[model samples]
Target: MTYGYIGSMRTRSGRRDDVVAILLSAAGSLRELGCRSYVVGLAADDPDTIVVTEVWESKEHHDASLRSPGAKEAIAAAMPMLTGEFTSRETTVVGGLGV
Candidate 1:
């Protein structure tokens, strides 16, 4: 089954742009690891909020991708700008626009 991850991340004040750039720059690496899509979006009214949506080939693929060197590096690169906690949801893709 396909796997999906949707999450909201809050960056330090004025740091959302930095976080988005890091995610965008790392997209190619994630795609190579079986990530079908990794999209980053900015919140319309919250400058510090970022929305992340991801689709992976499978749960295993997504988990394994996090273990890849590239993923670890990407996480580390974005860590500094992150603030507070993140909210995430995991789902099984039954049918959807991108599925």
Candidate 2:
């Protein structure tokens, strides 16, 4: 079974783009660590919100990715721009298009 994770974060005003860039900076590294899919989305109605949907080979892979140097750097760069509000869910991916 694959591991799926969806996370939504609220960025400080005018900081969404910067935070999004920071997150994307590590996308390549994540792929090398077993990420199957990684998508970043912005809410059209809420400019400050960022939604990240990811599928990993397993829960262990997902967890390990977070500990990677690139991931750690991205988190450090984006944290200050965030509003401390977040929503996240973990799931077992069964089947899906492009997944």
Candidate 3:
């Protein structure tokens, strides 16, 4: 089954741009990680909050990608822009409910 990950982050005050830049760089690494889809968006009601969604071929593929050098570097680079602890959840894709 396909694997998906969603991460929620909040940028430090006055650091939204920095956070977005970091995420963009992180997206580049994610692209090399067997990622089928990757997207980052800002929360509509909260400018400081960002949401990242990723789809991978499988859980194993996502795990392997986590250990990649690019992933490591991207994560390290993003750390400083974070305001609060980031949260993540993983799930399996079942039948889609109409969006």
Candidate 4:
């Protein structure tokens, strides 16, 4: 089954776009590692938060992505800009516009 992950990150003031940039830059690497979709966007009312929506082949694929080369690099690059602040929701994708 496809696994979906939505991660919300609140960066230290003025760093939301910075982290989004890092994620975008690392997108290709994650795509190569079985990430079906990696969508990055901002909350309409909150400029400090970045919302990331992802789809993976499975929950294991999603978990394994954390260890993927691109993910490792992205995490390292975004770590400093991040306040370690975030929220998330995981779900089993039964059906969707895109899997």
Candidate 5:
């Protein structure tokens, strides 16, 4: 099944730029890993909060990318900028529903 992931993160004090840079690098790495779509956007009302949304061709592809060295390294680099625990959720696309 096609897979999607949503991740939410909050940046530490004075780390918004660092976090954004990390996310940009991570997005590029995810694209190289065959992600169908990847987006990292900051919350308009809260500059410290970031939301990362990604879609993969399949669950297997997503899982494999998560286990890749590049992904791990990117995550590690982003960790220090985090203010609190990140939250993530994975889901399978059931229907487009013509949004």
Candidate 6:
């Protein structure tokens, strides 16, 4: 079964865009690591929040991607900009359009 992950992070004051950029910088490389889809979104009413949605070939693929250098670098770069507040959920992707 495909693995799906939905998560959100709260960035420090004015750092949401920066964190988003860092996350996107690794988007191109994620596919090579088995990612099927990766989407980033901002809340209309929350300037400090960033939401990320991802689908992977499997749970193992998702796990491996986190250990990737690009992912690690992105995380390191964005950590300081975040408020340490987050929301996340892992799901089994049954079927979906574009996914």
lDDT of 5 at 70: 75
Stretches of candidate 2 off by over 4 Å are none
Best-performing candidate as measured by TM-score: 6
Error of 1 at 80 (Å): 1.4
Q: On a 0 to 1 TM-score scale, where does candidate 4 land against the true structure?
A: 0.91
Error of 2 at 44 (Å): 2.5
lDDT of 6 by residue, 8-49 (tens): 999999998899889888899888888999999998889999
lDDT of 1 by residue, 1-99 (tens): 889999999999888888888888878777778888788999898889999999999989999988888778889988988986799999987776765
Angstrom error at residue 89, model 5:
2.5
* Candidates' C-alpha lDDT: 0.87, 0.92, 0.80, 0.86, 0.80, 0.92
Question: What does the lDDT read for residue 49 in candidate 2?
Answer: 98
* lDDT (Cα, 0-100) at 21 in candidate 5: 82
TM-score rank, highest first? 6, 2, 4, 1, 3, 5
Model 6: per-residue Cα lDDT at residue 93: 95
TM per prediction = 0.91, 0.96, 0.83, 0.91, 0.81, 0.97
Candidate 3: minimum summed lDDT over ten consecutive residues — where? 90-99
Candidate 3: residue 35 lDDT (0-100): 84
lDDT of 2 at 64: 91
Candidate 3 TM-score versus the reference: 0.83
Better of 2 and 6 by TM-score: 6
90 in model 4: Cα distance from truth in Å? 0.8
TM-score, model 6 to reference: 0.97
What is the number of backbone collisions in each predicted candidate, taken in the order shown?
0, 0, 0, 0, 0, 0
lDDT of 2 at 59: 95
lDDT tens digits, residues 37-91, model 4? 9999999998788999999888898888898777788888888988888899998
Query: What are the runs in model 1 whose C-alpha is more than 4 Å off?
Result: none
- lDDT string for model 5 (6-86, tens) is 988998878888878876876766666768788888889877889888888888888899799877887788788888867
lDDT accuracy of residue 3 in candidate 4: 88
